[model samples]
Structures are given as C-alpha cells and as structure tokens.
Target: MTRTPRGEAPDVGVPAHLAEHMTVAEQHDWIAGFLRRHPVSRRSALRRGSGVVAAMGLASAPWTLAACASAASAPVSVVGRHLSFGDDPLRSMAMAGELTAPPQGRVVVDLGQNGSFGATLPVEVRRLVSQVPQADGSIRASDQYFVHALATGLQPGQGYDYRFRLADGTTTDTATFHTAPRQPTSPWSFTAFADQGVDMVPPSGLSGFTNAYYKPDDTRRTMTPSTSMVDRIAATRPAFHLLAGDICYADPSGEGEPVKSTGTSKSPSGFDSFDPTVWTTYFGLIERSAASTPWMFATGNHDMEALYDDNTARGALHGYGGHAARLDLPRTGPSACPSVYSMRYGNVGVISVDANDLSMEIPTNAGYSGGSQVAWLRQTLLQWRAAGSGIDFVVAFFHHCAYATSSTHASDAGVRAAVAPLFDEFSVDLALQGHNHQYERSNPIRAGRSTTQVPDGGTARPETDGTTYVCVGSGGRPRYSWQPGEVDRYRGNPAPQGDVNVVSYQAVGASAKVPDAVDWSQARYLDYAYVTVDVVPPPGPGQVTTMTLRTITDTGVEIDRVTLERRAR
Candidate 1:
C-alpha cells in the first residue's frame, strides 16, 4: 500500500462523475467507507455472484482491480536490494534498494562481517523521487523511491552482512555481499545471460511473461522459469553475475515509443503495454542474488525506457534515466553512456558496452553516445592490455552480437563495425553477447573471419586464435527457433531442424533480412541457458593460465564447454 496517512479514510461515496479522477488511495478509502456503511451478510452476490464489488460498479470498470491491489497492498519494509562495484571493487561497493515511499526519515545501514552485524553503522543517502504519473500521465499505482549507499575503505575480498534500518525503528532483513579481491591471485567464476524480461505467470503455471490470468481469485501467483534459473545460478556461487543486456522488458514493445495510458498489471495488453510496475516485479525477482553478489547489467533495446528520460542528466541520450536511478553501475566510461564501463576482477578485465548505441536491428538509440564511446572503449582496452597491467584476459559483455549466427537477430553489423577490430586488436578472450535468443559459440575470429576452430571443449588461444564470441541470450522470456535450414551442426551432426548451412542475418537498419553464408559458428543450442566462465590463473611458474566457458541450460544441464588457454607472461 502507498503508505497511507495516519488518519481515518474519508467516509464519502464516490460520485460517478468524479470516480475517473479518483486516486488509488481515494478509491481504497471509498471502498473502506462503503464497507463500513453497508456490511455484506452471508449471502450470494448479485450479477454473477460478484459480491459487494460488483454492487459498487467497480467490477465494471474498464481497467483491472488487480492493478489496484498490486499498488494497494501493505507497504514492504524493503525490496529490490542490489549490490554493485564502485570505482574500485576491491575497496568499495554500492547498494540500491527500493521502497514504496521515503522512510519515516532515513535508511541506515548496519554492516559487519558476513555472519555478524553492527560492525559499522552509518546513515546513507536516501534520495527520494516521488512516483511520477504513469508514462501516459495517469495516476501511479504506488510510490517508488530508490536509495543508494556506498561503502568504501573496506577490507578486500571480505564478505559483509548489512541491513537497512528505517527511522520508524523497523529493520529489514540482512544480506551478505563479498567485496572484490585486491588483486588477481586465484581462480574464480562468474555467470552471464541476457534478454530475461520480467516474466508473469498465470495461476496454472503455463506459458510466458504475460500473465494469462488477468484477474485471479487471490494474491498468490506463480513463478517464471527465469526465477528458477536464478536459483540455479545461485547454486554455482559465482563471484558475480553479468546480465549481458535486455535485463527486464519493462517496455515490451522493445521500442522506445510512448506507452499506452491504460496499461497496468491487470491489463498489460500482451507485449505492447509499457508498464513500469514490471521493474518493481523484476527487482523483487533478482533481489535475492543481486543482494548477495554484484549483479552487473548492460542495456538492451527493450531497456530503452524513454518514459524516464528528462532533459537533464543521464537522460539527454540513450534514455538511461531509469537505469541511472535504479542501478548503480560504474560511470567511469564515456559520458552519457551509463552502461559503458570497465572493471577488473582477479586477472580478468570485464567491460560493459552500450551496444544499443551500435545496434543496427533496432537503431532508435544508435549512435546516442556519438563517437566518444568508441574512443573510451579503445582507451579502456589499451589500458587493460598494456604491459605490466597484470590482466591476463579481457571479456566484453553487451546486448548486440558482434558475431552470432541465429536467425531472428544475427550478428549486428554496427557492433561489428565498431568493436570487432578493437576486440581482435586487444586479443579480447571472450565477447559475450545477448541479442540472439539462443546459445551460440563462434570460432575465434580475426578480421571478421574465423582464425581458428575452437569447438565445444576445444582450446581457444586468443593470443593467437583471436577473440571468441558467445551468444547466450536464452535467459527465459521466450525461446526463438533456429533459422530455416540453419541447423546447430556439431561433430558433423545437425539438429532435427534442417540443413547444416551457415546462413544468418547481418542485422542492419532497413531491409535487414539479409543473410550470408558464415563459416565461424562452432556450437549452438536453442533453449533457455546461461554461461559460467571459470578464470583460473596459472597454478605456478611455467603453468598456463586458462578460462573455461561452459553453457548450462536452465535445467542444470551442461551442454557445451570450451577452454580458452593462454601462457602467463
């Protein structure tokens, strides 16, 4: 519920003419007063037994009461607690949490060792942004505010427990997060996926992100496959998680267009509605793992929430205003590109790119960053690859596939235009991409062609074999089928779909259906899956350093694995 004031509800009837203008709180108050005035007895309801609801004519409203309930529920102490790395992961961390409204005053964090509490307590920044009206200038269901906190000068590689304390003396549950190590000394692993939109299930637990049951008998709802996939990811105890892009499909249209005025949780209008409440649902879904470990994110085409853009900061281009508020990603990259930044973990340097700025399939936000992003990417790559940098491997994760062979969204020519040369020049070990809604690993490519064949379980020598590309976008909104006569040929055996042709779309702007025969696709899987990459530094002197990449399905099945090996300098 939207933090109702400490007063009695208005004991007034809702006038027919004024009902349309009534706020959700007022509607709730009107219902309370109506119930107080006319009590219902143990009898059958009129007009399909709808009870007092139908009698009040609210049941006949074009919108959904389900929406009202979603916004009208009791206030939560805390939700959507997420962790991220600050300028320096080893010495700093950031947290972002959501509340229905500003706390009675402020939210304090009590941090300590992983299992303990109260090591350091301090009041943090509680920036309150009143829930704006809906995208179409309609009343919002609930008040949503975000709180960001930064912890610096902490011990490196140490796990800490923290919880929020509101001024009202109420405390939230505790979550533990581990800081990044000060240096690359040992082995670790991380998981990556993309295109995982907020999935709403029906009562029967069948079918997709759209809730089949628009109106349910109660508040109970089912879970989506992506939710279960989070648990599977958690089981791996990854050092961190990287969502390549298309994090949550708040704008189901995948286009940064104006939203429909009538869209709500009750009537999302099926893949066309622009419901911001999906963000609320998404944060709640990922809060568990995101709270525990750094959940780094990238922007996808659907993530272009133009609804939050303002003429001011972080919204001038890319329409990243919502991300700037909700996520605490590193901002040291190109200006105006919140999603483009680079950080190092252990011996691996990871970079997040704003592929939407270079995407051709959906070019609405393309070139939003001008040419500065390319410059920053080049500088970051050069810095990481410089001698004495101690970085043995570099991985770039983004939305558009620089080199993929899926039918729906094949390799993006724009991204290939910008980053392909840079990646090959810097010997980027892995280019983890997402747009294509399947799993595909390409042979190590140099100059836009395969330099070496690195099949599943094969060794990839990026120092010589060039950069290998993997498209693991099957994080679970829906599955995309393989292209016609384009089978996932492996070990000379093809999937039951069709021929073993290497044809795919080189997704450019208009007339983008162009397909070309490719010879780089090495492995492919059409299902809901993610990739776990293990980074093992050299065991000792004269030992070879390696990064093993594995593709695991949502059902915990490991389908493909490849080892990228490089001799330690």
Candidate 2:
C-alpha cells in the first residue's frame, strides 16, 4: 500500500536500497516472494523480463540482454514450458506455446550431461494460425509456434541441465529436468487431474460463473498460497503431470460466467470466447511446475471450439484449431485424429485417446477417426504386450468416463460401446477419465462384472485380468455429486454418504443408473482433488510392477488409495 519514488526501479518487494545491494539469487527470491504476496497487477517490474532479469543480474551479458529484449515485443504470452515425452513414442518433445506472432530465428537446445553441455540441437521454428470467435462476435486471430527443437535420445531416469539460445546468440538461464525412466526399479509417481482453470482476472464488467459445488468458502479454505492446484502438485514433485483435459477453460464464458439455461441443454454465459488471455493466465499458473515436468494432455470436450450445432458445418476439424496452434501433441495416432497418441515410461505404457471422435455428447468428430483409432489402440496394446515389450501395465486416459457415476456427465454410453471391449481384450491395467468433476474408481471390471473388489488402500493384480477405471476430474473445477446417498464399493447396499461427498440429482440422476446391484463402484469422493499414481517396478526386468493410485485433495490430503499390480506377458 505504498508507492516508490518515480524514475527509480521499485525494490521488487524489498527495500529499494537493500535491493541494490542484494545478490542475484536474493533478488530472484525477493521477486518471487513479492509475486506471491501482492496482486499480479503490481508485476510491471517483471512484465517484460528486463527489470526482473536486471534485478537478478541475469542480463549482465550483452547477449542475454539482447535475448530478453527480443521477448519484450515477441508476443510470447506464455511458454508451454513442459514436455510430453511420456506421450510420444520416440520420446521426442515439441516445446510449443501460445504466441501472438510468429517467432523468428532458430532455437538452440543444449542438453547437459553432469554439469557440461553434452549435445546441442538446433531446430527451425514454424507457426500455427488460429482464428477464434471473440465475445463481441469478432474474430480474434493469433499465431502459436514451437521452438522446433525436438529433444530426442534423452536417457531415461537421467537428469539433465538444459538451456535455450536465442537467434541473437543469447543463452537463457539453465534449467534442470529428468527424463522418464525406461524401467523403474522403485516406486515412481506422477500427478494427474482435469478441469483446472486459469483463475483469470476477467476484463472490466465481466465475471465468471458462480460455481455452485466448489463454493467460495471451500475454495478459500483449500486453495494454496499461490491459489493454484499446480502449486500443490509441484509440492509432490511427480515425474510428470497428466492433464486429462479442459486445461484452461478458455471457452466463451470462462470459469466465472454462469451457465445460461437454454431448454434441456445449457451453455456458458457468452462474455468471452477463445480469448488468448485465458491461455496467458493458464501458462503463468502452471509455469512453477510445468517448466520442468512433462505436463502431458488428453483432449477434453471443452478444448474444442464448437459453437455451431450443425455437425456438417464443423467438418473434420474437431475444434482443435487453437489447441493445435499452441500445443504439440504426438502425431503417432491416426492422421485424422491428432489427439490420439501413446507413449511409455518405465514399465507403464500410456495411451491418450481422443473420445471426441466417437463421443455422443460432442459429436463434432463422431466417426471421423473411429475405425482408425480403434485399430491403433489394438495394435498399440498388442505391441506393448509383445515379447520383450518391457511394458507391464497399459494406461488409457481420455476425457469422457466409461464407468463414472458422478451426478454430472456419467459414463458415456458411446464410450463404453466403442472402447470398453478393447480395454478388456487388451487387459488394460487402468482407464483414467474426466468430465465428471469428481473422483471415483470402479472395481476390477471385466465384461460388465467385477472381477476383483479392491477396497480403500487395497491392491489388485490387473495384469492377470480385469481393469480398474478411475475418474480424476476434480482438479480445480467445481465438484460434482453422487446420485445415491452412498454407493458402496464392495456391496450394492445404499448407506448415507459422508460430508466430503454430496448427493445431487440435477447432474447425473437419470444417466448414471446401473442395472442390477452395481457393485462395481469402488472408492468415490466429491471434492476438488487429483490422483497421484505411483508406478513401482520390480527388482529386475520381467517381474511384477505395482501402481498405487492415491486420490488426494488440493490441500494435500490423501482420501483414498488403491494399488494395482501387473506383469509383462
């Protein structure tokens, strides 16, 4: 609540005179503390990177000053700082993010071994154009580009020092990253969630929808210091972060606009549509964690830009113009379905499938790549199961739920009809889903029956048979409820639900009903939570691998835990 004298740089949240005498590290820490305590509107000191870089003495080198200066007008809103090596077969990474203009010059990637630069990779840059409908019925156009530096041949389980070199021969600060392990000899964990909002400060006169479920009181209590779920995830320090979808909710209305009731269906309040600012806010929110971790993505329904109802008008685009521009998903799946891809880390093989291709809920891409995606899925699973495949478990994650019972957007019948059989046939160890806005897991199910009942904090051997389906949609969005009072995991008996879990009918009542005593429901929680899966490898290869799935609250509370064991066939 005080103003610094004009013409002199503000002390970056420290006493002005003391800041002048502080070390680079001290200044960096001071700036970080300032950002944490004060509103971002006071970030003019760090806005263009000049003041902050100077404050840290990082711009002392002439080349460094040149590189930082280029970004001043580069329109680089936020760097998609994370990698997705876990989702790419070659373990190559596409370092991409949203930008307002096409980037110039090549980027030099220095992969350091130990403390020295082991290899330098130079890649060309390219751009993807996006045209989105704005709130005022105008088109907001922008270009996003990848660094073109595809980092390959990285040794798994090895940590490397890396940095970037701009076109002007300027090098950036060194950052450290660890590659996913090819074989885990011990327990390894990764964080996962969906529906995380950017927490944007809306434009003047525009506000977000009031979330009825994740009330202000609950958010006030659970939100961390940065007021971000990413902060909590970073605290766990998982190998990677799996974003199940709806990364920013940069839709027409955003997170604050209330849903507009329109007949049987409802839409968001039309305040803004695909404004790049949403992504700007999103990248800033996760920069703390994503900059180092491989934050992989699975396309959710909201990620697409589908404003029209006519299916034919949408064409084969599937509403990923903006997404394709900003993010670089693996192109290993069917050419028609860029969202479908697979990768492996340790003994675990993960397949990110796009349900929009066959989704009855959002039919923009219905049947476009249905056959191809299925064929790819079968082949991918078969390859992972082949002799010497090294893969002990296969995890398939997508947006829609195949066996969720949340009060909103229950298990999609279309998903079950198309994808469920393949899961059983391939003996997938796990199926992760979102869109339900709650946390729920099913028993080890095969052919609509429970193959094994896994209690809370229990373990199951999915490698021998059956698959466990889990929903980790409660990342940061409003929580959904369960229809019944209490759906027991072991038995079909109805009991009173606990305080953490709520009961609501407006969302999943009619669609979530299961025939016969549906005892397949396992652990269920209705809160803003995420799932951390720990994949534990055996002492040696060709042995049993275990995956412990823990559903944790944003505030770091472990509510439910399930361990799954699998072995390579």
Candidate 3:
C-alpha cells in the first residue's frame, strides 16, 4: 500500500544499508519480495521499463548505484522463462526466457540434483527487441533480449531442478521438470491445446469479446482461466505439452501484416491492431507452467508474424525471427522454418508440422519451405517405423485443421492433401490441430476417406483403423459455432439441432471457400477447452499399448473420452 518514494531510488522495501550488506542472491530475493508486496501493472512495466529507474533518480542515489548498472556490466533480472524439448527429450532440452536489458557476462543455467547444481551450461543471448515509440509516448517493446540455453548429458526420465545463474553465484528460484523415459514400457502423459492467448489484457490485444467473457474463475491464484488451465495441466504432471499453434494472438488480424493505426492494438479489428506486448503478457502468464514443462508449439496462421520485417532479404522469416529466438523448436531439415521438427519420448514419436507452409487459407507464408517439410516428414516417419525402431505411436500436431466442422475454418484441403496422405501412409496415430476455436474429433480415416465409425469411447487402432484427427482448438479464445446444418460434437442438454449434414470447405487461393458435404464431425463443444493424453506403454513387445485421451472444458467437465491402442513392436 506504500507509494514509491519521490526523488529517491525505489527502496524495494529494503533499507539500503542492509541491502548493501546482504548477498547478491539475498538482494535479488528482496527485490522479488518487494514486487509481491507492491504489484506493478504489466501495461505500465512494458511502457515504462526505464521510467522507474530514471524517475527514481537512481544514479543520484548512491544506495542504488550497484543495481542501476548496465546489464552488460552486471547480471540483469529476467522474465518469461520457459523450456522446450530438443532433438533428444531424455538427454537434452532447450531453455528460453527474455530480459529487458542486455547481458555482458555469461548467463549460466544450473541443472540441479536435489538442492545442488549437477551441471552448469552457459546460454546465448540475442538482441532481437525493436522499440517503436507510439504517438502516446509509450514504447512498444515487441521484443527483447532472448536467452537460449541448452542442457545435455542428463539422465533419461529423471526430474531435475533448474534455475538461472547470475554473476557471483547468485541464482533465481528453482523449478522442477521431468524428462522422457528411454524405454517403451515407461508410462507418461502430456497436455495440449491451441488458440489460447492472454485473457482480457486489451493493451496486450487479448480482448475476448472486450471483457474476456470466456474466462471463468477457477483458482484464486491467477486472474485468467487460461492460467488456471495451465496450473491444472501442471497438476497432471505431463512430461511435455503440445501446443498446436495460434500460441499468442499478438497480431490478431492473422493477416500476416499488422500495421499501426490511429486506433491501435487495444481494440480488435480486421487490421491495424498489432501490439507486440501481448507476447510479453502471454509469456509472463504461462511462466507458471512453461517454466517447468516443455511446451512444444506448432505454427499457425495467426503466428505468421510479419511485424518484424526489419530485413527485406529475410522477410520470408515472417516474424519467425522473433519466434526462433524465443521458442527454440528442434528442426531437422531447414533453418528457414523453425517450427517443423521431430521428438521422441519413451515409446511415442512426436512431430511438429508447420501448417503455415501448407495452408491455402492464410497463404502469406505458405510454400516458404518449397515441399521440403513434407519430404522431411516422410523420411522421419519412415525412419521411426523402420524395422526394430522401438517406436509404438507417432503423433503429429499443427495448426490449420484438416478435418474440422467449424464454419469459421472448416478444413484446409491443402493441409489434408499434404499431411493427411502422409499420415495415413505412415500410420500416424493422431493428428492434433487448432485455429478453429472449438473442439471436434474425427473417425479414423485413411487416404482421405473415413474407414469406420469409431465412437467417442471406441478404441482406435491406427495401424489398421487409420489416423484419427482432433481439433482441440479451444485453448482459451472465444468459442466458435458449428457449421450450419451440422450438429454439435454430441447431443447436449437441449442439444444443438440442425439439418444433420456437415457442411465443410477448403479455401482456394484466398478467393473462395470451396464447399463440400461430409460426416466426420464426432463430438463438438463450443467452449474454452483443453486436452490431456495419458500414454500407457506396453508391458513388453507385441503387447497392447494405450493412449487414453480426455477432453476437458473450462467449466471442468469431461465432454469426450477416447482411447488409441496399438501393439508394441
């Protein structure tokens, strides 16, 4: 309740005499405790990063001189720390976070066993933040110094505590995360969702119908239901999470081009509403989970960020330069596209596909890979399925639904044509998709045709029944209505009645939405939702392996449940 002292360095509620006597780690802890007592609005922090230091007369105050030193000379505090799975989920992992200021000394990441550091790895920091002062005198820090750290030589399927190590052995608070097991018999789980963004932060461009009507109160620890869902996911204790894309709607227009306007990012519009701070807010919000869990993200149309076209030569990067710096996705084929990659955890083989490369609906960044992604995908699947590969299930996730029934974006024939055939040929167990803002599942299909009706509770054998496609796009955005003449995912209390026909479409060259009739929509729910998959590895080879999937809503209801089973090799 106390205000910052005027014409003085912010005390951080600590006496300077005592702070100077305390250790650097203790000083950092004191600052963090100060933040807990006196909260700072995210908006003000983004706009006034340096205002506090300047207005507080830090340089004039000898008590604050050491803290006010440049980050290049001293270790700077960081925000939005997160992790991702590298090429090897067991032995290696990727760590990323952002810093407002530059770093001069090596930023070390300590992998802790018990309470002590077992291994220390240094990180590479890149200056990717560009500030464009708005007419309102507020700086739009769309980016900042991103710290990318990789840790290896870890024991498979083990839990380790990690923290950022600053100069003089000072460290951030520790968080625990688990790696994947190395054997097929190891059981594990994961969480998934898409289209989720920061809730109700209009300045960050997270205006869900202007008031975040989709958010519901769950735990009092967080303000947004998205964060609550993240906590719930962490409760499930997943080894890793799969975010199908549309990660953060920083550029809500999804048109690839986000231009500044007289009435800017605070309000939602067809165009001219781009605020880069939304990424900061979203990342800060997800730190609870992303800091401890590996959130593997795929590419979506909304993510085709064209906001950072700083260099015309690499304009094809499509704001992806920013993404690459923040989320170090593991890629095999090309550096040009960072979203396409493959990872393995125990008996499951996971892949992240960049649907932006194959989308016809949002074609701005389409074809950037020139068919290489598909080729690499084919090779990866083949290698995973080779004789004695030890892989039992292969799951692929991406944005741009290939078999959805939403009226907004029913199905991208381009996505279906490119990946569906490959998935079918390679016996992909599941294809998770997003960008539609609802949840819809499909029957097992092969060669673009539904093989048989696998009901909600039916067990699907992908090796024979075909691949099952699911659109868990209901991460945390506004709910979407089903296509006209089609029923909801399933019958509800009153039930959504229609002509009982699935009207679908494939976008054609940005000029039209080609229509067709289909009947693959299994269960539909127009609400904020997420998914959790419990992977049950086989006891031994030639045994039954199961993946029990539970589709849960924001209201804490299990609307649909399904199982994917196959024999272990």
Candidate 4:
C-alpha cells in the first residue's frame, strides 16, 4: 500500500516508516499529511537523509543502474569528409572527424550539393611525399599520397593508399591511383568505350539509352548483352579507361536531344530539359570503375554540341564542366590548347584531338575549324620525330568517325579529308572514334579511301598501306542498327557479322608496310565489350615494339585477341 511521489504504486518492498503512512485514496493528494507530521522547517533535512538511503538502494540494485548508465553513454560513429584530385595536382581532401584521423589516400567522397550541409568543411594538405622506384623494376610503390588532402602523388606508374587523421583522434582511409607498367617494355592493358549519356526515356517504350547500351535485358538475342560485357571489362582491371565521346547528353536543356540546324529550324523536337544533378548522378554511375582508375575522355558530336545554345537563356550548362576541368590527367605536353594535347607513355604516343570542332560547319565558318588543334597535332608529331623520341606507336582519338556505316550519322567526310593526310604523314597506328552508336572497324588505309574495297561492301581486302579506323561508340547509350549486308570486312575488319568488333593495328616503324594477306576469319562484334592493349618492347636491344588488342567481356573473359607487331624495313 506504499505510495510514491505523484504516483499510485511504489516499490513492492517499502521501508516500514513509509509503509505505515501509505493509502490508496491518497495517491493524488498533496503531501499535507507528511508535512504536518514532519514540520515544513525540517523537510529539507529529511530529504537529504532520504537521498542517502536512495544511494544505498542504488548500490544494491546494480543491474537497473547499470542499464540506465549504458543507455545514457552509448557511443556513435559518423563519416564526415572525403577528397579527390582537383584542377591541379594540389587539391584538398574532404574530411570529418569528431575526435581522430580521417581516412586517407586519393579519396572520392560524396559532396552532396552547393547549399547542402557539410559543403564548406575545411580541407587541408597535411603532408607530401615523393616515392622513388624500387629495385624489383616495379614502380608500384613509387606512388605518393598527399597526407591531409588524401590525394595520390604523380609517379611514373604506381598506385598508393594513404591515411588521414581527424581532430577527434579518429582516422579514415583512402587511395590514389596511377597508370601501370612503369617500363615501356612491361606489358599493360586498358579498356576503351564511347558514347555514354544519361537517357531517361528512349524511343520504342524503352527505359533509355543507358539501359539499352548496357544490354541488361536477357530477352534480346545479342551475342553479348550489357551485363556480360561490363563484367568482362571489370575483370580485366585495365590500367586506364578510354572514353571515345558523348559522355553526357547535356544540351542547353541539359538533356539528350537531337541537334537542330540554326538556318531552318526554329525549334528542335525531342529536346528534353535535364536537371544538372542528374548529369552528375549519371556520370557517377557510368564511371564507378573509372573513378578508381585513370580515365581519358575524348569529345563526341553529341557531347560537344550538347552543352548550351547561344540563343537560349540557360546560357552554358556546367554539368560536365566541373568534372572535365578537375580530373587528374597525364600531361599531353605544353600547348596553347590544353583540350587538344598529347601524352606519351613508354614508347606509345597518344594524341587526343577535338574532332567535334573540326566537323562543326558553323564553328568552322566562325574560323575555329580546330585549326589550332590541327597545328598542335602536326607540331607535336613533328617535334617527337625531330627529337628522335622513337615512339613505337601513335594512336589518335576524337569524337567523330572518319568512316562509319550506322544509319544515325554519316562518316564525317570533311574531317576525314582534313586529318587523313596527317595520319598518313605521321604513320599513325590507329584512329579510335565513337560518334556512331554501333561498332565498326576498317582495314589499314593510307588515305580516306579503303586499301582494298570488296565488291559486296562486306569487308576490306588485304592492304599494306593505310591507317586503321575503329568506331567503338557503344559505351552505354542507346544502340543503333547498321544497314543490313553493309558490313565492311577488309583484311583487318575484326568482326564482320556481329554487333561487337575487335581488331589490332601494329606500328612497325616509318619504313615498314602493312603486311598483305592478314587474317580476319575469327572476328566477331561484341555488344558491350572493351578492348585492351598490351605494349611489349622488342628483344635484343632493338627498338621495335608490339601491341596486342584483346576484346574482353565484363567478366574479364577474353573473347577475341589480335596482335600487331612493328617490323622495321
């Protein structure tokens, strides 16, 4: 019958002094009876004595007190910051810590939005280190990571992981990466893809181009669906990833839309408005792997014209601008135009040109014609030759295809006419393109014309003089069909029948010629595969180099292999 303060029920076992005064009817009553008996003046003293008694009870009730304390002192953990390579080698790493070290290395974090919380977090560089190559001939350990900012240092070819500390004494982990195969002779591989964009609605009731490009559906009869090919590419773990073009369909509206001619068209159809956030999300998904590795991007027709329209109030779309300008890319040498640049690794020289600028009639009319780019290309190649750089191979990349058979876009005759001679003059090994959404490969041809044209337009015949043309635009956009029976199967056409194609082009030196009677019977088109190139140095103190292309599935399965060897005359 004992009563608690302001309550009806008390502990089952009560002290005799309190029990004697308890009553069920008194539950809601004030403590008038107790005050009267105790005298109000002495109440404070009485409460102090009761507190001592309660302390004794708490000591006896260990389980209950321990449970209360446990609930009150629970520990919580949160991740607060991250970092990535910015406009230059020096970039601040993102971080958050209540008590300790944040994770380190090259850290790619989720930086929510401009007005979003945690956007203004302080990012500082704690330290810098230089990694020297080791004795094993492997420079893997040569990679350096910025301590506070969580970025990797520039190395010949290496990858490194780093650690970061927070103010609260906590720590976080991150990693920075670089190209592999430090020595030119060591063999390394990489994947190539093109024409990926964010498409929410596609024609024919399809989800969009991204899903179709990946070939995620099993209902289709494609030789290799999207999942299979993506898996294959991932398994290979190529040192780097090459994106041909059409990265994001960011038009003035910031969505994938057909380009309209300014002269006649007042309003273009199928032009959808896009949210800038969507672009980042789409790229985040498309480049999940490449973000961890070095990715090289070349422009495509869609990507170049997709940014903004001068006539529109939207002005210029900055969706892809932030990423493109901030990525950590290898030096393509000093040039007036950084967009059009060249980078040499080992004995191979890669020249990335702005083909979109070359093909756009309006830009050319405005006196752009990518003339500066062309001059840069010519000068860079000539400089390499003059210095006796001994580059074993030369590969050029742009958005538009010099040769294409897809119904979507015609082969840019203008671009071919302008750049073909340059390729021939420099003895360029391969020209990688991706404007067309399908895959196509051409035989070695010195000029725009094919070396040996087949009567049926099936494939190219064997030839010893020409630059190889490869159209691998099917990165993750919608797929388009080639005209039936219009396959170009020259001696070098990799896949003459399927949607995927793979071929290898060799650089044998300036004096060597393309060998006649090359083999192409085993070539097959891949729906969603990647091409890997392995560069090997010549034996016995020779300068000759060899490159092998392996078309692999997303699971890292080698579907086809072609070898190109440089033979000096």
Highest TM-score: give the candidate number: 3
Against the reference, the lDDT scores of all candidates come to 0.66, 0.58, 0.67, 0.41
Clashing residue pairs for model 2? 208-256, 208-257, 209-256, 209-257, 209-258, 407-507, 407-508
Model 3 Cα lDDT, one tens digit per residue, 1-569: 11111111111223434432332234335544544554544454443442111111112111111213344443466667788977778887888876544564678888887877878888888655433332233333333567778888888878888888766566667988777777846667888999887664433322322333533532212345566687788677678889998887764433322233333224334323344545656677788888989999987766654334332332236446557656777755455667888888888889899887887665545677888888889999999999899888999999988888787777888888899888888899988999888888888888766787776677888899889899989887666667655665543426643432476777654445788676666677776678889899888878899998888776666778889999888
- Better TM-score candidate (1, 2): 1
Off by over 4 Å in 2: 1-80, 86-91, 97-106, 128-130, 133-137, 142-146, 168-171, 202-213, 216-221, 224-227, 252-272, 306-316, 484-517, 567-569
Off by over 4 Å in 4: 1-153, 162-173, 179-182, 198-231, 250-271, 286-288, 305-338, 360-370, 452-464, 487-526, 553-560, 567-569
User: TM-scores of all models?
Assistant: 0.79, 0.74, 0.80, 0.57
lDDT of model 2 at position 545: 69
Best by lDDT: 3
TM-score: the better of candidates 1 and 4? 1
True-vs-predicted CA distance for residue 265, candidate 1, Å = 6.0
Taking the tens digit of each residue's C-alpha lDDT, what string does model 2 give over 1-569?
11111111111123334433433234344444543554332133123111111111112211111223435544332243555563443345544433222344556777776779978887555443323222222222333344545677766677777766655665655666787665667787888887776444322112323344345545423533223568877777888788877676654243323122121112334322333334544665675687677788888766654321112221225445445545666666777676788878777888888876655544434566748888888899889888888788888888877777775566666677778898888889888888887778888988866887677878888755589998888777666666666543312214543332233322112123333335577677666778889877877655666889887776666778888886544
Per-residue alpha-carbon lDDT of model 1 for 164-243, expressed as tens digits?
77776776788888888866577889999998876662211112265442234311122455776787877777899999
Model 4 lDDT-worst window of ten:
48-57
